[model samples]
Target chain A: MIDEHLLDDLALQNGLLEVDAKLKLAVGIGAILIGVFSPSPVAPLVIAASMAVCTIVFAGIPARVYAALLAIPVTFVSMSIIVILFMTGGGEPLWDVHVLGYTFTLTTDSANLAVLLLSRTLGGMCSLFFIALTTPMVDIFSVMNRLRLPDEFVDLSMLIYRNIFVLIGESIAIHNAQVMRNGYSTFRRSIDAFAMLAGMLFVRAWEKGEEMLVAMDARCYDGKFQMIEEERRISATGIATATGYLCACAGLAVLFRSFRIF
Target chain B: MHIMEGFLPSPWWQIWFIVAIPFLVLGLYQLKKLFAEKRETIPLLAVAGAFVFVLSSLKLPSVNGSCSHPTGTGLSAILFGPFITSILALIVLLYQAIFLAHGGLTTLGANVFSMGISGPIVAYALYVAGKKASLNTFVNVFIAATVADLFTYVVTAGQLALAFPAPAAQGGLLGSFSAFLVIFALTQVPLAIIEGVIIALVFKYIIDVRPDILVKLNVLTQNTVNRIREAAS
Candidate 1:
């Protein structure tokens, strides 16, 4: 089992991580918004392609890593598209079939809708992938802090983020031990083992929480978490380039919508 | 059973965000009260949030040689209330969106409403009813978890169907909803059952090993714990 934590570490090591987090955040949000609100598939499809290029080329993230990241969402999105495609009703029937006394039909309208949905979803996903590939959660938190989100909420997120790695490590050790003992040999045994593991994890997490509280108190800890924000030079040129690219994407979306070139 | 990113249209996703914001506010208010009452609960809540994250991601072998992930929210909803569970769900969903890319930020509101608000509300309701009915702890937990899991998917189906209704079915929304419900049910039913059993067993173990924690959390009274012990013996 590959350590899931390694995924974030890989993002941190990406070349684009050094880029201003605000820029990446803006690009990501801009792409998603354009993808979602666009009237035609042409713009979203273009955005998807461009975002993928940015993530793979500009970000210097490996193509394989990007592909692996997309595989799950692609599978799920495809399933959903199929549901949209096979939904009975609307427009001329492209294909009709009977199965188990129920008639299934593929209509032109449904097909069009599915195409639009697929493009939009892919475009949005690519934008998100770019952000996940480039920015670490800590930086995102820093941005949130800068945006003046409540201190408690930010602190809670930091605590949860730190402990998630710890709990994952503990879970991996317990799962390995269970596997060595043939804990998952049968369905019944797997359930038993899983339940036992979850119970033990809860107890361990609870104990860890108590210990954390004691440790914090020992340092005269207040109810606040002090975060050290790194000073990054926000270059005007970088911001200008990012804005230009986003404006171009928006311009293309507008042109495509007005032209209706599907 | 997350509604993937870009799944809901602009108005629909925004509507869900608007609908879900109140519950999130209420949850924050509850957390504030809890923190004021017991500062130690802050770390405990963080740990609980982490536990939900780790537990939900675990894949367990299911009946018929299939595999599925557990929601892990019903158990927490029972331990903490639905309001707090909603906050936990928000954190878990955010983490999954950023780190795992399992869910998307745009659809976060919809996902949180379905899995966090609707499921936990139903689970907590069922748990309270079961306890009042004097049902066995294991059976109650099983019912709560399974129903809660099933309800989450049902709500997701509804959200999708509402966004994209089928023209063929006379009642557009109803028809599309049934179509999605049938599609999700094929996988969700068995998964829900498996999750239910897993949570039940875990609840039993907790009752056995650390009833004290439950008592402290006000989930169980001292008299109830003694009765549980007697019944086990």
Candidate 2:
């Protein structure tokens, strides 16, 4: 429930909501691939910056929410890159760190690797967030079906997607009840409370599952779930802008492959 | 430890994608067979998956005065068996990636391999072994959960080390492996223990409330169910 409203709610309300899903998908997936494949940090940094603009401005997602979301991956990537910086060595030493009986130096090569890794993480995450904040799972599921994925898989996924909100709401209610009673006042009590929540949630989910089956059987369900495709034609200008941005990023990557920040 | 997007570089991510596909197909195959035999289980499985998703989002209080999230693989593997759990894990990982930004699409394969496939396999195997040995059920579940959680992180560390080895003179793969392990395993051990305790408690509570479900699913034998009932009484 902590993140209950932030994801799909924003996507549903995005400025790009009425735009063609395929174009958005292409932009997102293509940017991700190009970002990940880029060798130098410059292209990835550029990709990340542009994605921020697209997600924040074009998609009309809240800047504060976007920054908070970016923080999660940035924190993780920064911590891991520190490990890379300390462990690898080559070229001129940039900084020396000593721990226990050994000295670890951050060398030029390691620094470059760290920057590359960080930039890639930023670029990839921004592109990913762009897709996530713009395209909802329903659109992706419909896309999956159109791609000729197995019907059973797609159907199960739709069911799962529908159920996730149910379970999230259920768990939140349970947690609120527990909090009211001080169920988590202590470490031991918190564990007990959480386990109890999980147990109760599982039982309820099982019952819901059974209820769903009965309802489906009552309707005489066959294997088909109707997924409608909205006719939102892709505009030529949209195509031009997307390709222009992607090509600019790709060209920057090729041009800056040998450029080093440090 | 869901690897961040583009963290594994090119070759490693593709390699993991290749490795994770067979398990996905196998899970799908098992799911289809289950659907044919029992259509009701399909909805149950779907709901159970969402249940896992919510379960993992929970912040479990640990003994070390810190809170962490559960992987949900241990309980799921026991309840649904490993193959189906893999599919559930894959979906859960995808949701975590999309909604939570915990993992990403390109690294989805790597994340699936570590959290979904490896953790569940370890948990299911250990649980089977414990049952075969007639080990104490609660204790067995605890151990299985902890070890499986730890092993998933270890595999992740190995994957990272393989992708980015240190200088050969500084011990290369082995060197970076331990470094990443230090970063993950240190904070993870206590968290893993907390996950284990919670998982066991969840299992115990399930047996207490709806022992019939476990018995019918063949997760617990009649003898074991009787033993649990007798012990409870």
Candidate 3:
């Protein structure tokens, strides 16, 4: 599994540091909307390709990291698309088979639907990757706050975000201790070890919550947490460039659809 | 079991988001009420949220040689009610989407509905039923966790089937749902069983060490606790 904490930290230090966080967010969301609404695969394919280039070239994210980030979703999407491919029948069969009194066939319509779904999914993923790889969670949360989400909801999210790392650290420590004692040498032992770890973690979590509350009380914490907001000004040049690029992509997709250029 | 980013088309994703909003609103209301009543609930819910995140992310070894991760929502549903679990599920799902890319922003609604709402509702119902029927604590926890996990996947399969029905099947939605359910069941069944056992043992340990906490959480009544202690002894 990828260490997302490390990835987010790395993203904070990457080349897209100068761009406005909101602009990056807008670009990501815009790409997804376009990918979803476009009539043909042309728009999605183009969006995905361009986003990949921007991430690898402009954002300076490592190609390997980008590929690794995509690998899991790609595998999942492929599995489901394969099911889609096999399940749709009754048209011109590219391949056909009979099993247990049922005809299993891959048809033109199924192939088309599979391709569309794959392109749309990939396009959307690329857009999300651009945002996730370029921006950090704090900025995203700040954006949510700026969007006027309820104070309570944003505050709770912030608290959970901060504590996730703490709990993960504690879990790792407990897991390591158990492993050193050969707690997972056998299947039964593994189950026992896991259960103990879970039980301990639960107890520890409750204690930690109490400790945090006491500490907060000591510091005169009221019900709501105060967050410091950083000023981020959007640039006209960046917005213009993003708009032009999106429009050009849309125009190309329209042309492709009209000309039937697969 | 997350529905990956952009997996559902426009209308389907929108419909799910609309369906999920009411549950989320109710959860927020419940959370506010809990916080007002007990100030400690703030930290408890925060830590519970983190617990769900960490626990769900752990890759456990399954009997089928494929790795499986427990949802961890069943335990939370038993401790907190289903409504609060929905709020935690939203946070966990959002975190996974933004940081881990496991699920998507657009598809968050579908994932939350399956993993957060439907699964926890079923788990909480099973738990309440078990308590009413005076079932053994271990058996009750096991059934709730296992069935909750299975139900999450079942709902996920149903969502997928609804989005893309099988062309070959004459039964339309039902047929497509069965196909997806069967595919998921091959792996999800054994994984659910393993998760159930793990959660049961963990609950048993918690009961043994600190029955007070469970009682404090209102998860176990005094009579039930006495029965459990007697059964253990």
Superposed by TM-score, candidate 3 places the C-alpha of residue A236 at a distance from the truth, in angstroms, of: 1.3
Output DockQ, candidate 3: 0.60
Q: Output the lDDT of residue A245, model 2.
A: 84
Q: Please estimate how well model 3 matches the true structure, expressed as its whole-model Cα lDDT.
A: 0.84
RMSD of 3: 2.1
Number of residue pairs clashing in candidate 3, backbone atoms closer than 3 angstroms, sequence gap of 3 or more or interchain: 0
TM-score of 1: 0.96
Worst 10 residues of 3 chain A by lDDT: A1-10
TM-score of chain A of 3: 0.90
Instruction: Output the chain A TM-score of model 2.
Output: 0.96
Q: Model 3 segments beyond 4 Å from truth?
A: A1-6, A257-262, B226-233
Lowest lDDT block of 10, candidate 2 chain A: A1-10
Clashing pairs in 2: none
Tens digit of per-residue lDDT, candidate 2, span A1-262: 3543438778888988877778888888888888888989998888899889989998899999998888777545665787799888899998888889899888999999998998889898998898889998888887888889888788888888899989888988999999999998987898899999999899889989999999988988776688887767889999999899888888998998888877
Classified by CAPRI criteria, candidate 1 counts as medium
lDDT of 1 at B226: 92
Question: Which of the two candidates, 1 or 2, achieves a greater DockQ against the reference?
Answer: 2
> Which of the predicted structures, 1 or 3, would earn the higher TM-score when compared with the native?
1
Error of 2 at A124 (Å): 0.8
Instruction: Judging by lDDT, tell me the better candidate of 1 and 2.
Output: 2
